[model samples]
Target: MYETLASVDWARLQFAVTALYHFLFVPLTLGLSFIVAIMETLYVRSGDEKWKRITRFWMTLFAINFAIGVATGIIMEFEFGTNWSNYSWFVGDIFGAPLAVEGILAFFMESTFFAVMFFGWDKVGKGFHLLSTWLVAVGSNLSALWILVANGWMQYPTGMAFNPDLFRYEMASFWDVVLSPVAVAKFLHTTGAGYVTSALFVMGISAWFLLKKRDVVLAKRSMVVAASFGLIVSLYVVLSGDESAHQVAQKQPAKLAAMEGIYEGEKRAGIVGFGLLRPDKQIGDKTSPFYLDITIPYALSLLGYHDINAFVPGIDDLVYGNAEKGIRPAQERLDSGKIAVGALADYKAARKSGDAATATAALDTFNAHVGDFGYGYLEKPEQIIPPVTPLFYSFHMMAGLGFWFLLLFTVTLYLLMVNDITRHTLWLRAALLSWPLGFVASELGWVVAEVGRQPWAVQDMLPVHIAMTDISGSSVMITVFAFAAIFTLLLIAEVRIMLKQIKIGIEGGH
Candidate 1:
């Protein structure tokens, strides 16, 4: 047996693996680029040799990460066409447009300027090079915007129509897609995360330098910058993340429920503590049952409703909500019905006064009943479908890491600023050693977000089963293994290079 089940599962695993790996580099690139720009600007303004040195050191790491990010991201895009051909075809009109915009507006802009910023040290003027660097940062973030705009549309589809003639969804209005609430929130949340990611990365490396007693002035300066950025981003992450969660509550209740591990309606759902996310209703005591109870009774309510003790829907409600007798009964059919009725009313008023094409299209929609919503309406219990253990733990782990980073970074930054950064060498050494943890948290955060939305690759709109192409499991497996090997080697090489570079400082030679 070629493992038929593996084909479907394999694609998901590969996607999760690759996306997680790629994400590890993305935030660092985004954050590092901006910080590098800032460092370069400081250099340009003051003509300081130290700023130049700082920029060069950081740029080396940024370049390595950027290369890996681009390489891995290319694979994801290719996988869309190859592995997710059906998803591409079905939502191509609606989904493809944003991706196209990303390609044209974000990717090209970033890549073009990035080359200039990176390679044109001698060719471009100092100011022009700095401008190029900033543009690269802008372009990178813009890339995120378009991609999120598309993702936001997916999160909450807006201003789109199902064209029966084309057998796909089409954009009704560009502006509708742009102003989507989910996209807007996610863009802010993701951008903040990028800044935080880079800040923590810088903090970690700088801490290492301090621990080594290598360069006090430079290390302290880097710490100040990183900490300041980290503080702003951390606070913003919590605030914006809350807003994003509310958006999820409105748009994707099922996912929100999954995050909270709430399988049934609760008047006062607690903020979940680390424990078993058993949706089977079989873990602890049946009544008032949660594995390790330390929940804020009205936290979920507050998050979703700005009120205490609000009724939050569980997985059951979401499942029933999508059922045949439930809500969300093929939006296309509903639209078609409304259009047909309106057309009939118009025809009755004045058959000769109207354009025949409008009535004809309405009649076609009503008569043809063209929209085919596969099995998305059917929702099953978590008990029925076993959760991926990796995804389950990954989500919790990411959440855990986020809280940890927020807590530790806050305390340490406060301590460092109040007392001298060098005075608390233990903390600095700890922070230096722990720099990788921030990136780890980020990687895990992405893993949780992407993997938790599993079984349905394109959120709730399209199932992964139907979306995947006719690719063999063996082929996907080969690439999966190949990526693992290549990425591992690259990671080692990157760390080694960064370590060596860190040793070299303001006076120049180590």
Candidate 2:
């Protein structure tokens, strides 16, 4: 049992299960928070009974989703301490600050304002109620900002220096972490995606109401909000996603290679649009051909480098040095990492023997190579590459969904301007059917972001296998199933309650 508990695979599965479950509800909470705020703002401005009822109805749904989100989110955070103690220890100095600040600043702000937003309608002044709702929206976004900052730092580590003696990373600048390009891009792209999902969700539900010919005025107004807001944000999501791609191409080329299923190095790389991605080579097969993929000519180069002709290094280019391309091979990093580890050992030994000069020299050598230290733990340079098939499909799924969402919302918005939205049965049906696709797109985006950065828990610094707390397989497996069961039960309850509320309509929902 003890031996099995130390298995890395089980530990990863445990965390993945919990994280994925938590994420299912987060985007809805993020998007719905703002939508409800906007609805309330409309009620405050117009003082219309129908608008007030609409605000309360949507707020009820938002509260249900937010409640579940809070539950699942807390579980994932706790896992950071329980299952990923090593990861916590290594980056805690730098990573802990943002998470701590998120709780101290954003979490409290949201929870406090959320109570006012949810419960203080008639009890509070209209102006105060509107302010509270706006604060809830702002607070929720700020929470997302800080969380993404932490995640972005993991992807593209900055504002930190390694402390080899302490065996951890230390924060050099909090502002740098908060304003990291990757973090900012991710936050915009992700929150924009949240808005897109919310729009789709509202449109779909409103479409259903239109189809049933019940609450036509309320549904039409909801559709108007959903279409106009969804279209704008879907466009922003694509634009921000492009910036995120550029960040990845620069900082994590191995991930970009996997995303395109590009095995061979090339000067003009294409982002594969579609085609089967299969295992072309097992580990250690240098000359193996990669999967047959349909390439979108110059798209990858244009998106990744903002230059249509820019060289995009492939998996082989990264694994084995491409001198023509000036790509430093992974093996070089692996070798440097070993030197860093050895120097770290020497530093410890010298310090133990009271040789100050020797310790200082060894520390310098370790620091020089410490950026590649995660490579030391890898048995093969080939392991630096993430799983290609999963990354490729996940990338396409997300990109494809983004385009679908854009088209759908654009058409919906246009139709909204031209004719009566409730009368168009086909369009209404299409919108009604699109609600699930939004969730699918949201999940696939996360799958691409997280799974595409595989092997490394912190890119080029710490691999996930090295980050686990060394717990047993059974222990991890038990938690995996436990979370699965818990989330499943909660989801059932939420759906049931939400359905009942939706059935009750505007007035009774409150």
Candidate 3:
């Protein structure tokens, strides 16, 4: 059991490392693609040579990031087959559908025009080049749309039914999976965050140019576009984030509870604005949950349910039943799940022995408790509760950074339009330093989303231990180190190349 658990942990670590590393490039690719396209569109419309130079310079950096992003991304898909074969077998029918479309349609569309957009500057007509650039932008986002759709389905597990004979989940409604509200909200929120990251990257680099007193016109123009774009998408991020919180509260109450560090259910629950969780606090303990805290009254209730007085279940309320609130205990679900697992084994055996009557009875029993099937694998009810400290801090930090981005964009835009932004050395340095925060904030948002839904690969249906392939712990550990080393090299190469291009300035493009 220890060896098996170690192997599972190692596999999880490997995937997490690869995913987090790959994501470093994904948001930049998503945001920069559109930003570059917009720059080109300006050049096409105004027939300005300076716009063309700006477009090409940014496009060069975008290309370098895109290449590295694609390389890292392909490995993540393959890891599904290598490290998580069981999960693939269980949900392949449902999960593979969108991935297939993403690769065949969205990926191919992006890759095909990517060449035209990057290399066809002189060979293609101005109109055709502009069209290709927009297509690349559309294709990149469309790719993200399909991928997020697949992930959102895991979070909510909609439009799928288990096939007892096949021992897997099958898609019931393609459109239901495609048009899931969770998917829509996740796509919007994730892409909006990516846009904000790209805007920060551009604005920060432009700030560096202003500080250095080089390419003043190009720097100012880029800042104007980035600030305007960042401000709009930042607002969109807030709206989409709210919808995502509501979805989590409805579908995964434990995660919502963890995010807010709530251990007791209440009406009009307050949100912790900033707090240090008490290290000694435990479930059902008399100790206060926080050492120091500031909370906004009724904010959590309003945010989670769109009702200021709605009851929000905490970790305690979820794990051990809340009878008055009509919430079932984790213990009950675990019992039901165990019965379901046993019935499934009996059903398979009976079918093999040609006992149709017994098989039918077993199948009925299995179906009755299949809703909590994944819980059967859990040894304790506490497994349902995710790491509260990490989730709490990550959620708050991500939110705090979001507000900062909004302020940065607003102030930067205001200063540039009215006062000469170049004259403000302090603000320029702040903007330049603030670029990496966008990446930090994007990573934190993901940590909150992924870590807060711990122990389950597919919420309430498939546990992570069951999803992993039967592999040795030492083997997985070696690969974990290997991937870390390789990814680090890739990141270094990207940064070095990008810095070289940035050093060359806008005139280098001409």
Q: Whole-model Cα lDDT per candidate?
A: 0.70, 0.84, 0.92
- 63-127 per-residue lDDT for model 1 (tens digits): 87787567667678888887778778878877777777777865678888888887888798999
Tens digits of per-residue lDDT, candidate 3, 397-463, equal: 9999999999999999999889589889999998999999999999998898888878899999998
**Candidate 3 C-alpha error for residue 74, in Å:** 1.7
- Note the residue pairs that clash in candidate 2: 4-473, 5-471, 5-472, 5-473
Q: How accurate is candidate 2 locally (lDDT)?
A: 0.84
Count of clashes in candidate 3: 0
Model 2 over residues 359-393: C-alpha lDDT tens digits? 99999998888778889988888989888878778
Model 2 TM-score, all chains together: 0.96
Worst 10 residues of 1 by lDDT: 377-386
Q: Which of the two candidates, 2 or 3, achieves a greater lDDT against the reference? A: 3
The CA lDDT at 198 in model 3 is 97
Any runs in candidate 3 off by more than 4 Å, and if so which? none
Candidate 2: segments with Cα more than 4 A from true spot: 1-6, 281-292, 507-509
